[model samples]
Target: MFSKSFVRRALSGLAIAGCLVVGLPTLSFADGLPGFTLWGGVKGEDSLNFRLDFGGRAGSWDRYRLRIPAKKMKLAVEQFAISYPDYYKGEFDTKNVEVIVKDKSIKLQEVRWNKDNHLLEIYPEEPIPAGSGVEIQLANVRNPSFGGMFYFNCQVLSPGDVPLLRYLGTWVITIS
Candidate 1:
């Protein structure tokens, strides 16, 4: 036994609440979008490697390199992602970076980013044909330049407060 006015008021309140919940995310997302960049670099002793340059206070960039022996020229990079703190906010611009193999550029497709898992995965549009020595470089990254402590890692996602680190390793790809 309720009046029409009461029911109308209740419905209006619920609608407002729903709109607030939905609108909040849209507002937050609009402020600071996340982006990423992909590049290649060489891994070895006493090498500069690659740079994970940041432009703001909450973003960062990092690079990892792997050297494959001539004998092993085929390997599957099944996993590649970047992780940060739950509070961290930013994006990655993938177009600025390039992946060079034997001085020839390779196309990367199927790029997927998972915020829940804090991972970024990419698969080559075309497989690298059997080849000898290959060099990979990860460069041209734009990230947050604030906080001055933003950190990033390859294969393992970390937070911004910790010491900024990079991953360096080698992979063997054999075509047969």
Candidate 2:
């Protein structure tokens, strides 16, 4: 026969030990990930809403890479353009921007950067088909030498039959 107090103490010790064992590892794992205290999450509606985050040793903004997942068949992109809205006057270079799809480097036949209208139209030699995706590598990009929120509009021109570039959505990027 076990005493009541002895049984209670044993259970209490087991509970405390269980919490420390399970909780310590979770706290450690969270520390390794990027901290988003300064910049908030994405703030717009879009199908391929894979929000991009920027964080590094404060001074270095050599280049940044972003992956834009392929859109569904509804409005497939034949030739797309990253139009820097008429309002935004940030000084980022588009001369060294490169498009890569599925580990293969793609050549953009036309790279138009209209500093006046703030639009960078990128026309690929081969149109990106449905169900495929691409990664946009913005090299030699000096991303806002400061920290804040920057939004970019992505418009797509669908394949045959349609002549207009449909409005997709806005890419909400946060820099911290």
Candidate 3:
């Protein structure tokens, strides 16, 4: 007959060995960079597009969605601006900060900076459905001059009387 202590020791050793066989390769690593750090890719899926639209009522927003083409590197037009062409009818050089996606313009309700996370949360004046694929145009910066891996994470604040900022996902902008 085996003693209880011996049985316990044998089970623990077997558990450790089982975990090593199934857990070591799946472990994830991060750079621990906070506040909008760039990424190569997150969780596999990496096609990204920031669609901007400016046709909605107050406190209402249409989803901005983008599908990055296979050749995202060939995007030539560099002059990107985020403005309510439907509101002010102005183009670039308009100091009003905006989120410009591709070559579209839209008016936003508010822009907030999360100092704790170094994240820029854009608040559209409307409600967007949960878990919906959306577009986010960084109205200011142009594509990386030196092509490489650029990452963008999206968080949305639903359009309502009181909205909470929810993290959508991360976008890895690969500029060839």
Candidate 4:
């Protein structure tokens, strides 16, 4: 039979080892999202939601669902523009870009990805009515080779209005 002190020590060691075995998985390392911070002065109302269908990894191909709430669309949008930071080098497939309204794909006159200007312009075949919630679908997007915070400002040009782009909201996209 084992001595009393030796038996106690063995049980303690077993407990510690069991804890480690259970806790190790929770502490395992993963390249995940950075801690959240309010880097920009954007207010809650001025923020837009963009979802990455797949985990946004560097150098990975993914799809982006950029959503525009109805409250943000106070004017009928003739053209939608997304202006990203100059350092963002992600590639977009303009041919597969889509505008969705109420789960239906809206026809687009053209979708332009201007590398020099760092803009993705979406022109619908017909003007999107005011107060309509819309989703801009960007397919076959190649994430940049590096991870960083990218601020995408959304602007819209209204039909029969001043030829100036009006600010709608901002999408703060982070690729890990």
Which regions of candidate 2 fall more than 4 Å away from where they truly are?
Answer: 1-60, 71-76, 85-89
Q: Which candidate is the best by TM-score?
A: 4
45-132: candidate 3 lDDT, tens digit per residue = 4334443343212232233333333233232221211222122211222233544343555466666544344444455554433333
Model 4, span 1-176: residue lDDT tens: 99999999999999999999998886543223222455554788887877887767889998888999988889899999999999998999999899998789999998988899999999999999999999998989999999888888999999999999999998878788
Superposed Cα deviation of residue 48, candidate 4 (Å): 0.5
- At residue 157, give the lDDT of candidate 2: 82
Q: Give Cα-based local distance difference scores for all models.
A: 0.42, 0.61, 0.39, 0.87
**How displaced is residue 130 in candidate 2, in Å?**
1.3
Clashing pairs in 2: none
Candidate 1: regions farther than 4 A off? 1-48, 52-74, 95-97, 128-142, 148-151, 156-176
Ranking by lDDT: 4, 2, 1, 3
User: Each prediction's TM-score against the native?
Assistant: 0.38, 0.63, 0.36, 0.80
Which prediction has the highest lDDT against the true structure? Answer: 4
Residue-level lDDT for 174 in candidate 3? 32
Where is the poorest 10-residue window by lDDT in model 4?
A: 27-36
Across residues 67-90, which tens digit of lDDT does each residue of candidate 2 receive?
566553344466766775454434
